[model samples]
Target: MNIIEDLRSRGLINQMTDDEGLEQHLNKEQVALYCGFDPTADSLHIGHLLPILMLKRFQEAGHRPIALVGGGTGLIGDPSGRSEERQLNEESVVQGWVSNIEDQLSKFIDFTDDDKGAKVVNNYDWLSQMSVIDLLRDVGKYFSVNYMLAKDSVESRIENGISYTEFTYMLLQSLDFLRLNQKENVTLQIGGSDQWGNITAGLELIRRTSQEGEDIKAYGLTVPLITKADGSKFGKTAGGAIWLDEKKTSPYEFYQFWVNADDRDVLKFLKSFTFLPLEEIEELKKEVEERPEQRTAQRRLAEEMTKMVHGEEALNQAKRITHALFKGDVKQLTKDEVEVGFKDVPTYKLEESEKGLVDLLVEASISSSKRQAREDIQNGAIYINDERQQDLKYVINADDQIDEAFTIIRRGKKKYFLIRHM
Candidate 1:
């Protein structure tokens, strides 16, 4: 399929300046396109996934991608999604973020030096050198106050207040487009829906900067914001943003997040997030309708995303933890797997001893009293290391420990606690 059609199937295209023209331009030649990311944080989160994947889609379609890091624009924040002004970051801090974000961006695209391979560039190279006089005379002259005020990014912020620094972010972004067009031969800009104004501003800069009647055609496209069916934001869980960096969000945690995808949303995410073949995804969709109890879609989504982000070994570990927990075979887990599998479960550290399960249950508050603990054990409702403990005086022996450091306690069907041997 054509790149636009493919993006449309993935629900990636939000707005494009001219669909037919851009498609014609794309099919005619391998043109250069760009997407700009600001160094707002040290790592890009799952919310940043669409754009990164979109760039990859273009490169695979035989186009060149220029991943623009806004090292310069990051200092003056864009007020697209915010209700209030952003506290500007110090240059030194933003520079660190730039380094981190650059490294993260490098992983997703083809960056090998070759024809049509991706290129990473910093706007800081040009934006830091331009003076106030030139910025005003060249870029500021093209944008009118009325036009800037009408943009959704500025219109929403005008009531609360907007700083001149942020107000001129359009001009600064426009200048980046102009510079890229001049230097890199970049002819198109892509971004989130909120950046429609800025992307158009860049196209306008290219238009006005060139002499009249000069051929300086450029284009802009944007992707819609990801949203959940129940009106919550996407890529958010009780924990927080799902980051691309495994250190911030472990591979196990990331895998579990997708494994818990809502029945309503899993199929949509499989298409939008994975490059799985359409036929394969459609087959998985049939499984969702036929036997959702199996959660086939959720499993595939989790496996695809976890493998994509964390590699095969980490994905295997996550699956091993999951399978062990499901099969009531906690003894199969290693120390690291136990740590990740039960990271959010209640934890109580204990001095190593052969503590009887009944007394330990009462002491750890797993049972309300000794009578309750004995009743729970006798009723076979308590589990030590996932093995049923019907004996009233089962002891926590070294054999009960998974990997000699931790014990798993499961009460009834779902409640779990991890006891660490200190």
Candidate 2:
């Protein structure tokens, strides 16, 4: 299938300017396309994955993908999809964020300096070079206040109010497109749905700035915003946004996020996020219907996502943690796996070499008192590392520790506490 058809099959094309012309343009030669990611945060979240993956998809189709970091415009902030003005960051902070985002983008797209090699550029390189007078006389002259106000990004913010800095963000972004087109021969710009207005504005600037009869072919495309079947926002959990950085969101947490995807949303996620062929995804769809209890589809999605973001070893560790937790057999897990798996669980430190199970439980706050701890042991309500320990005199020693570092204690079926051996 053609690249457009492949994107269509995956339901990725949300809004494309001149679909026919753009498809023809992509087919003619190695199209150089670009997408802009603003450094609003230190790490890109799962919310940013669609566009980044879109760039990867294009690259796989023999196109050159330019990952543009909005180091300049990020300082101003885009008002699209916002209720209030964004808090501006220090130049040094934004630059640091820019470098971090560039590194994250490099992991997803190859930039090996080949025909289809990707490129990472920062708008700061050009936007910082232009003077306010030059911007007004050159790019700003083409966009009237009326024209800017009509844009949804500005129009929606009229009641709440918009800043002059943010209001003019489109001009800065448009200048980026025009500059890329002039310098890099980039013809297409893709982003999330919120960027349509800014993207079209860029195309407008490109058209106006081109000399007569130049036959400008710049285009804009936006991917739809991801939503959950339950109506809550996607990429969000009780812990907060699911970041691509493992430090921000551990591989186990990331794996669990996708593994716990709602049954209603799993198929759509597979299509949008995975490079798996349609045939394989179709088979998984059947599995979801026939054996929902197995959660085969969800597991596949988790494996693919974890392996892609954190690599094979991390994925294996995540799976090991997940399996050990599920089976209530955490004895085989390494110390690192235990740490990643039970990261959010309450923990207590064992100060002594050996302590009675009841004393340990009371000391760790796992039980309200020694009396309760003995009662819990007698009633078969407590377990040490998934092993039922009804012996009130049983001592939690080095044998109870996994990797000689931590012990898993369960008060009941689900409530768990981590015990760190000193």
Candidate 3:
């Protein structure tokens, strides 16, 4: 199957300018395509996954893919999907974020000496050096205020406000496409559904700016805005964004995010995220219906995605940590496993001169007050080292240390605390 058909079958195609024309263009060989990512944060969240995956698909099909970082556009935020004008970030801040994002993107796409190896570009390289007079005469002449105002991105913000900087964003983005087309032969631009207006603007710019009979053509394609079956936003938990960086989000948490996918959304997620063959996916769907409790589909989904972002070693560690935590088998866990599992739990420190279990629990805020801590201990709602410590007078000394430095404290069934001995 062609790349477009593969994207359609995988549920990745949300919108496209013209599939027939695009497919014809791709069949000609070594077509250059690109997708832009704004460096709005230090790390990309799950929301950035689909477009990046689409770029990977194109590269696998022997097409050249350009991953454009929006260092310039990020300074003037893309107002396409926002209801309000964005608070522009500082130049230094945006530059730092751009560098970090570029590093993270490298983990996903290969940049070696393969024939169709990917390339990275930053819009700031070109956009920052252009002057207002040159921009208005050369690029801005093609766009009209009426056309810009007509877009849903601008129209939605009219009731509140839209800044001049943001309103002119499309012009700058279109120029990026024009520059790439001339410099790199980039013909197709892919992005999220919200970027439809900007993508089409670029395509139009390429058409209008080309010399007579240049025969250059451009296309725009977009992927669906990922959302949960229950209509909540994706890539977010109580802990905030599910980052691609391991330091920001541990492998175990990332695995759990996929493993806990709602029964209704699992199949759809598998298609969009994983590169599993259609036949294998169909078989898994059947297994899901026939034996829902087995959760074979969710486990496979987690394994594939975790290994993709983190390595196989990290995936194995995450799996081991998951099993150990669920079974209360802490003794079997390594120091790294303990750190990953309990990273978010509240922690307290004992100076080797401090008092007992009650004091530690109160200090850690695992209990509301000292009286409450005493009550919890008496009622067997407290555990240390996975063992119930029911006595209020149980003074915790150096003897209570696990691995000679740490204590795992639990209040009730869910709340956990870590106490470190100095």
Candidate 4:
């Protein structure tokens, strides 16, 4: 299938300006397109995956992709989906975030200095030097206050009150588009559905700024905001946003997050996120109905996404922990894998080595008292390292450790506690 048809099949295209023109333009030539990411945080999360993958899709279709980091505009936050004004970060802080985001972005898009290769541009390069007069003369000339106020982003914030700083964000982003179109010959801008107004504003700037007879017909496209069928937002867990940085969120947790995708949402996620063929996605959809218990679709999505983001080694490690946990055998997991697997489980520190299991339980408050601890042990309710602890006087020693670092203690089918040999 063609590029547009492929996108349509996967439901990636939410809103595209001049669909016919874009289709023809994409078919006729390798159009240069750009997408901007604001540095709101030091690391990009799973919520940011759509656009990154979209860029890859475009690049694979033989188009030049430009990943623009909003270092300049990030200094002033975008109010695209916010009710209140954001607290401004220091210039240094934002710069650090910009660097970190740039690094994270590199993992998604291949950057090349060649003509067809992807380009990474920072809006801060030129935006930081422009004065207020430059903004008025160049950008403000095109955007009327009425047009800005009518936008969904601004209109929503008007009641609660948005700052003049944030109110001018569309113009800033539009300027980024217009400038990129002029310098890099980028004719298309893409972002999330929330950025439709800002994108169209950029197209308007391109239209007004171009001289007569100049072929500066720019276009904008957006992807729908991902929503869960269960009425929750995607990329969120109890721990918070699922970050791309393994340090912030371990590979195992990231793998588990995708592995547990809602049955209703998994097919859509597979279509939109994976580079897997349509036939394969359809087959997975069938499996979701035929054998939902297998979670075949969820497994594919997890493998593809985990390997794509965290790489092959991390993906294997995540799978090892997952399989080990399922089989109730975690002895094979390394120290690092143990940390990632049990990071969120309840943990207790033992001051002394080779302590009695009863004493350890009472000291860690896993049981209310020594009497309860013995009762739990003798009653076969407690387990150490997945083996039932029937002896009340069983000792938790260095030998009980998984990697000489920690021991897994289980009270029942659902409860787990990690005791460290500190």
How well does each candidate superpose onto the true structure, as a TM-score? 0.95, 0.98, 0.93, 0.98
Which lDDT tens digits does candidate 2 get at residues 1-422?
98899999999989999999999999999999999999999999999999999999999998999999999999999999998999999999999999999999988999877644688999999999999999999999999999999999999999999999999999999999999998889999999999999999999999998899988889999999899999999999889999999999999999999999989999999999999999999999999999999999999999999999889988998998999999988999999998989989999988898888888888889999998999999999998899888987898889888999999999889989999988
What TM-score would candidate 2 get against the native? 0.98
> Looking at model 3, which ten-residue stretch has the lowest summed lDDT?
108-117
Among these predicted structures, which one has the highest TM-score?
4
Which 10-residue window of candidate 4 scores lowest in summed lDDT?
108-117
Query: Considering TM-score, which of the candidate structures 2 and 3 is the better prediction for this target?
Result: 2
Name the lDDT of candidate 1.
0.89
- How do the residues 114-164 of candidate 1 rate in per-residue lDDT, one tens digit apiece? 645679989898899989998998789988899899888999998999999
lDDT of the candidates, in the order given: 0.89, 0.93, 0.87, 0.91
Error of 3 at 135 (Å): 0.9
Better of 2 and 3 by lDDT: 2
lDDT of 4: 0.91
Error of 1 at 298 (Å): 1.9
Best by lDDT: 2
Which is superior by lDDT, 1 or 2? 2
Q: What would the per-residue lDDT of candidate 4 be over residues 1-422, giving only the tens digit for each residue?
A: 77889999999999999899999999999889999998888899988999999999999999999999988999998999889998888888888998898898889888987866798889999999999999999899888899999999999999989999999999999999989898888999999999999999999999988899977669999998899999977899878999999999988999999999999999999988999999999999999999999999999999999999999999999999999899988888888888898888889988788899888899888888999999999899898888898897688888898888989988978788998888
lDDT for each residue of candidate 3 in 245-329, tens digit (9 for 90 to 100): 8989999999999998887888999999989998898998997899989888999899999999999999999999888778877
